[model samples]
Target: MKNRNVILTGAGTVIPWGAPSTDKLTDILRQDSIFINDKGEPIGEYLYSLLKTQMGKRRAYNTPNFESILHFIELLFEYKKSRYSMSSSFFRINDFFLIDPEIQNKLEIYESQKLDKRLDTSFGTKRLIANEYYYYELYLHFTFLIKKEIEKYETVEEKYHELNKSFNRFLHQVKGENGIVRFYTLNYDYLVPKISNLKFFDGYDEKTGKMNVKKIIEDDYIDCYYHLHGSFKLNFIGEKSNDYSVCYVQKNFVQNNLIPSNIITGYNKPERILNETFYEFYQKMIEDLIKANKIYIIGYSFNDMHVNAALKRALKKGSAKITVVDKCSLEDFHLKYDKIIDSNPDYDMNKLIKFPNTYQMTTEALKAKAYLNGLNDFLDNLIRSNN
Candidate 1:
């Protein structure tokens, strides 16, 4: 049976209130005071308070440093759980965290030192005592030294949460045969999974290497999350000795030992199919989406050439209809198309083979229209008819 599908896109299309318009997003991104503390103080003031409390001294706190990075990460995770998960089915996005190069290099140095073997009990104790100061020093170095410029109107966390909720609703409303709904995101954040509470089927048996899909029964909502860009919580094989080891950026420091390269920041494209496990799973997601009756896109711009190529390949073989939900106009879509066509003339633009059966709608107009149009009823009927 054909499954009804909807895709929402924008900076924060899933927020309960609705995805902010492009103008609103632009304004928010431009503001410096957007990052606020729990008590509604500016981030700078909050950092000063924290430093005074910790160091017992009053000093000029630096902006664009590790302090802000840690604050941003903490605030991001905190907000996701609170504001984004009221009624969404699941939230998952591609790579969310982009680690800085300086931080990556430091982590690499620490990892190289611990390479040969697991530290013995005695060595572990001594190493902690010896490097405790250095660890904190490294923490401060990154926190105080690294500078991150705020985007003119972007609150990455806020937008992410908003979009997550919207997408969840869209997916949750899907009802039909046991057809699959797949999300492929270029983002590296965990907002989607966190907001939707969907588990990423990593295809591993806890007891064995045999891979399997975590099944969902009929009438169950289990949308597949494929992170084409990786994730913040992802860990490399053999990176940590114990399965229970928790890795997180506590305050400003990574609490667990992890190499910098594993963090997946910088401009580096992830190695294609790093392992057998990931390759099979990724291939399956692409295949499933291609075979589905409909494909909905939200938030992603299809800017990456590699991803665009993959989509083209999938469309060539699939009969699925494509709906691209973005904040762009028909003119904007044409401009993007012209650019793509210019670069890849071999792509059949005349036949519409690559982009035929595609639809585009502005996010703001869609929301207002959805309200007036009673989207829930429409979606329910669509699902029923399609199935």
Candidate 2:
């Protein structure tokens, strides 16, 4: 028996209160304020206070840097509400040639300057991109706040706190078994590492609290975490400023050369799958999933084509049974599993599938097994005494 457990969790498993779906985030953008909860109370007061504490206790209302950041978030939220009002899914027109005429007019010179379409004239594609950037930027901001708040928990007992405890406990379990847990997150925030209290290593040394992959694999004692798309922590490129430090937060500064990491959204994700860093993490996740005896997925919507493709490949390559833990209906979950099964002609259903309810049954079986084993031992002793 492969007595090892490998868990793959999405943003839902991390964020306590927020619905872990992109549609739910769109609902927040449609709200009056991102800070206000569904009850209309400013639930974001704590977030504001934390930022204020970091920026300066004395900085007056609406300073240029402070106000600008808030304005960017507001603009993004409003834009998503306006653009995605009628559509169930957001669309990003990434085709440079299919850009809006107005944007093309402004960048006509750069458009003319490009010698070839393959020469990477991305400046012209800015207008083609959707309003989703604001939504993502706002998300990163909120996630950072959430991470800071969760870190304050010395002992968690609340329902919301359970998510953090679950992650912490799961990581420790994997470590105890001398197993490596690879986290490939779609989130731009550093919440997983912050919550797991692990180091960030992306196979290179940029001195940004990151480590090398060689050291990670050679050492059986350490767990590895990777940002599949990218992260805001890698925003400043090679700036080497410990942005997590309170001093950096107080400065409210962003470098001029800040690339802000590559955040993929909507249908443009597949294009990023080939990126050097992104591919590295994605390949490693597939490799681990194929090697695992059992895989537990929490809060991940099996929606992304690129991710689903990798998952299907991994399922076909290995004999691992999967348990999806989420609020989706059994039929909905089975529909996703069916797609994976269809990929393999000789798929064995009995050995490859399970659900959340099955997990409960397994726990019960363990208790029953213990009792039965004890009863058998007692019966043997009684028979020996009778003889």
Which candidate leads in TM-score?
Answer: 2
Question: Quick one: how many clashes does candidate 1 have?
Answer: 28
Q: In model 1, what lDDT does residue 109 have?
A: 45
Candidate 2 per-residue lDDT, tens place, 1-387, comes to: 224445666654544433234433432333324334334433233223333444464454432222233333433344345534422133222121222344334223322231222333222222122223433334444434433433343224365455555556556654455455555666555556655644645444665444355654554333556666655444223122334212111111221111122343433345444533456667677766777656666666665676777777766665665655444444554455455554454343322223332221122221111101121232233344446
For 1-387, candidate 1 gives per-residue lDDT tens digits of 546342323233333234344334323322324333333434333433333343333333422333233333333233333446512233221123333454335333432342112322111221222232223223222221111111122233564553455445556654234544555555433445556644544333446533344541122234555455443333433121223133332121222222221123222232323322344445654555556566555444444455555556656654555544444444555444443232223332322212222332223321111111123333333344457
- For candidate 2, the per-residue lDDT at 142 reads 48
Alpha carbon lDDT of each predicted model: 0.37, 0.43
lDDT, candidate 1, equals: 0.37
Deviation from native of the Cα of residue 291 in model 1, angstroms: 1.1
| TM-score of model 2 vs. true structure | 0.50
Q: Which candidate is the best by lDDT?
A: 2
Q: For candidate 2, which ten residues in a row score worst on lDDT? A: 366-375
Runs of candidate 1 with Cα error greater than 4 angstroms are 1-167, 175-178, 197-222, 238-267, 270-278, 329-331, 337-387
